[model samples]
Target: MSNILRIATFNVHKGLSTFNARFSLHDQRELLRKLHADIVFLQEVQDEHAKHSKRFSPFPLNGQLEFLADAVWPNYSYGKNSVYPAGHHGNAVLSKFPIINTENRDISAHSVEQRGMLHCEISIPGWDQTLHCICVHLGLFARWRTKQLQEVKRFIEDHVPADSPLIIAGDFNDWSLNAGRSFAESLHLREVFEHSHGKPAQSFPSWLPILRLDRIYTRGFSIRHVEVHTGPTWLKVSDHAVLTATLAHQTA
Candidate 1:
């Protein structure tokens, strides 16, 4: 039997439905639990929001990331990229294994966009090597995104070991499809859907996904299966569909 790892990536839209019409953090938590992913990459995670805590009926006092991680994911790390009066939001990584180390690198292209990449070194049980995970939320502008992509590549090269397993997942906002080519050439990482289905999965506008905004890129793992969670039930949670993949550890 192959050693399998299931992972998921999602832009939770700060735990709200499309247009901020509803507070769906509770619903989002339930949906994530169903995935049963060993590691989850999340973008636009609301680390803190005083207003929402007051307005929403069951807002988690600790924070959105902690609330979602709950008991399922005992080890988690959050990187706050954007800050405001109400609170702040950013990217997060939830892991079933122990997180030995973590860092939040600021990759914001300019003052207007507060972007970041969260890197976590996970200690998988009985494994000889640590698994490197990066949770990212890039800028919207094409130029800014290009710059941020390069930064991510550089970060990986400087920090992550060349032979270690790596997974970078999140919302790239790269509708132009440039990120896929760049990462393939630079980091030698393959997007899960692209490797399995010939192209990245469409994950934006959950109700009728037409844009490929979310992605899960991997190295040193063989993808066994990939899925894009859509339809009515998923749409009620966030604007971007949840992307999940099952991978087999490549033993040398």
Candidate 2:
């Protein structure tokens, strides 16, 4: 059995291209399949959008999480953060392993921006300990994001074990790099890109990524490789490019 795990995170922009001109969930699904990630953390996933279904003939009858998961990732969980008359959207996690439990926590600092953390406890076939995965989407403002980070810390302290394997991935919206330091100091977790290459990966504006907006942080795992997928296809798929990391459990 392989001990190494492949993980990825992406903000799908609600299955639409920049400015909502291109509605192409199929393209996003195809690109995700090519990544072959064992675990995927998604932000801006549409749980239900009645209007979109009517507008786009190809929109899956099921939610975007189910459509993207397909057959590869059978176990998945979605957290609804923002709700409207049309529908709701939020964070989602798709895992190849069994998801034993899940919870969606509303972490929004204010009413203006709805955000959430989709926490999932997963059991690998042969692993002795369960893994905790949190798919996060923080606020746009620094102060609000700081508050949300504290909430995240509190959530972990209250629910997750200290020594358990933990993975947190998604769009942080912290372009100033403040969140990284906070997480490192509080949770003792290492960001995958920083651990691998000494700095966070820039993943915003997929076409010409210049902002470090997405990230993956882990505890009890050693980073082997980290990549920020870009180029034409990735650019067209979503406004934010995909972030991937290869990691293995630390030897005892």
Off by more than 4 A, model 2? none
On a 0 to 1 TM-score scale, where does candidate 2 land against the true structure? 0.97
Q: lDDT scores for all predictions?
A: 0.91, 0.90
Q: Residue 16, candidate 1: how far off, in angstroms?
A: 0.6
Q: Any idea what lDDT model 2 has?
A: 0.90
Model 2, range 17-77, lDDT digits (tens) per residue?
8667789688888888899999999999986999999898788888898999989899999
Instruction: List model 1 lDDT by residue over 1-252, tens digit each.
Output: 336899999899998998898998888899999999999999999989998989988888889998999999999999999999999999999999999999999999999999999999999976778999999999899999999998999899999999999999999998889866787678888899998898899998898899998889999999999999998666578898999999988978
For model 1, what is the error of residue 140's alpha carbon versus the real structure, in angstroms, after optimal superposition?
0.7
Per-residue lDDT value at 71 in model 2: 97
Quote the lDDT for 142 in model 1. 92
In candidate 2, which residue pairs clash? none
TM-score of each: 0.98, 0.97
